[model samples]
Target: MMRLSRKAWNNVVIISMLLMIFFFNGLHKKLNTQPVEEGVQALLPEQSFILAMAFPELKIERIGTSWRSQSQQETTWQGNEQQLEQLVELWQHQKLTIANLPVSKISQTSADYVASVWLAGEQLPAVYQLYNIDQQYYLLDKRLQRVFELEQADAAKLFPLYPF
Candidate 1:
């Protein structure tokens, strides 16, 4: 059997111990690093809304429109019954089935005319709502998925379907 001398063995043991010490020291330095707040500040932001509004370049797609009652005492945005029926019929002709048609569901403050109908081949069906309190028409933005209160002035500019 080939044997290592005592001095050679000692040298080998010393080299292994030094390597072990070096690895442990490196591990200790990593564990003892200062608090992570410095590294994290760049990742997390302090403000979100200001960032959205200030950067007008960031396009915000309209999700829907809100209608307000012409008169404060009116309580609801009233539309001609016949006109509403025709609107529904027009949508039906386009192959969209509306649920809860011609029904008024009253809320605490206002009444909502809601129709669940699908648009084209989209999996998420769009909601058609006529709010009685505001007595106006709103188009829910399918992309943003939120209803916007429609302004009579901005109505024409927002949706081409109904020009006011």
Candidate 2:
């Protein structure tokens, strides 16, 4: 029988382990990765302005050219009409990256918040659910069942009053 030195035996064991790893790696099934859709897609439909936004904490309504917020605690928001208008505009025209499937298919779990927005000319308000998965923000439209992945800054822009 041919005998090998201690160093040679160690090298052989290491090489064998490396070969096994490479073999298993090659045989492993690859994850089906969907290409990210890149674009500035509008968060809300065009020409749609929120006439009213109802959250668990507060309800904001459009009064004439301005807006007002009344809290559930029977308190009112201190922000003026300009701030309300800016909030409306952010909802109206904010662009976000639409979260693609299988994330959309998988992330239909419980939401942190569910809010309703009454848009102009719409009798029924559109419902939206906000979710946080792995520290990333996602907004799901209950009506359309579409999920839009939001950036950290965009989430802040959309919900300035709400605590996350």
Task: Give per-residue CA lDDT, model 1, range 31-91, as digits (tens).
Answer: 9874533211211112211110001111111123321112223223233445434433343
The residue-by-residue lDDT of candidate 2 on 25-110, one tens digit each, is: 76663434333345556767787877899878778898887899887764334567788788887788878777864445535578
- The window of 10 residues in a row where model 1 has the poorest summed lDDT is 48-57
Error of 2 at 90 (Å): 0.6
Which ten contiguous residues of candidate 2 have the minimum total lDDT?
29-38
The residue-level lDDT of candidate 1 at 100 comes to: 28
Model-by-model lDDT, in order? 0.37, 0.76
> How does model 1 score by TM-score?
0.22
Clashing pairs counted in every model: 13, 0
Candidate 2 local lDDT, residue 113: 74
